[model samples]
Target: MTTISNTERGAAKVMNRTDLTQRLVARLHKDEAVVGGIGHTNWDLWASGQRPQNFYMLGSMGLAAPIALGVAVAQPDRMVFALEGDGSLLMQVGALATIATVEPANLCVIVWDNEAFHITGGQKSLTATGADIVAMARGAGLTNSTWAADEAHFESLVDEALGGTTGPRLIAARIDMTKPAGTTDRDPVKIRLNFMSGIAPPDKEG
Candidate 1:
């Protein structure tokens, strides 16, 4: 197997979260489960398209990855994704280690590193000062981690991850500070019901 280091991925491209989210959404054909982290992450996922397989986190800061991890573990055959902001992921960095320990082949984590808390005031984040999330993930044992250098590369990584390359995979996308186009519906109960009902096996009736 050929191994590529994070630096080998090339210089990180500053991208738009909305575009990245749309790219990710367009590639979903297998009813993949997507967990959106709080604020901008879910907002972009919501703006892209609201599917039953998409779960939007309302108030939680750093739970998207953990929640996706659970979903991936429960449904071992389904592709699961977690879209989280850099600040939120920093809040729960330890989750990366936990995900590595589980070693779920179907789990993919995407961190939108905008270098600031875009949802709140645009405060400078650790990443702005040169923190490398992909490196941190690799250190935490998610060796498949890589930084997406550009849009095409991002699509390729997403395709590979969804195609069942040994995961849990983590992709760190350096993004711009533009605001999301829309907001997610603030209904946690409906979100939960819909996501659960969506991921339910086709043969099983709820």
Candidate 2:
């Protein structure tokens, strides 16, 4: 078992909050898709906005992957991106196995590995274990796994992952756990509405 402290990791994927959100939104800008997020504030920012797409999350930290698995299995045709933090992913890794078996090609696990739980006071996280994130996905029977910390690489991986045959794909986007910049917990009503929209019949948008 080996680990690399944030200090040792050096450098991080730096992008303005809005820019990051926009970039990710572009990737996941599809209706009938269920995107699972892990962080409260970050997820809230993506949710509270006019996403127009479907997104749900486990705001309490960890559990994003499992939720993503559920959505992907339920909606195998549409894509499901699990935008999660390294700390959150560490908390509930067993979901990886469930995802592996479900084999939903529409599911993509994008881990914003910042080495810490940004919402919880930016404390260190298990990602420091420097555990090969890509290997972890492979161990869980996921293909199309890679890691990126820069804009160019991330863009490429996103395209490739989405273009692939699907199933479970993982992208460990290396970033820093900076101060939280997002909204408060979401309204349960809106959450349910978004989910309903994901699976609702076409004539039921009202």
Q: How many residue pairs clash in each candidate?
A: 0, 2
Worst 10 residues of 2 by lDDT: 1-10
What are the RMSDs of all candidates, in order? 2.5, 5.4
**Model 1: lowest-lDDT 10 consecutive positions:** 1-10
- Error (Å) of candidate 1 at residue 9 is 8.6
Write candidate 1's Cα lDDT for 8-42 as tens digits: 32377799999999999999998999999999999
Candidate 1 — which residues are off by over 4 angstroms?
Answer: 1-5, 8-10
Best prediction by TM-score: 1
* TM agreement with the true structure for every prediction: 0.95, 0.79
Q: What are the lDDT figures for the candidates, one per model?
A: 0.91, 0.62
Q: What stretches of model 2 exceed 4 Å from their correct place?
A: 1-18, 32-34, 44-48, 58-60, 198-206
Writing each residue's lDDT as its tens digit, candidate 2 over 53-144 gives 55556465667677767766766766767777776777777777778887877778877766666666777777776765666777887756
Model 2 residue 60 CA deviation (Å) reads 5.0
> Using lDDT as the measure, which candidate wins?
1
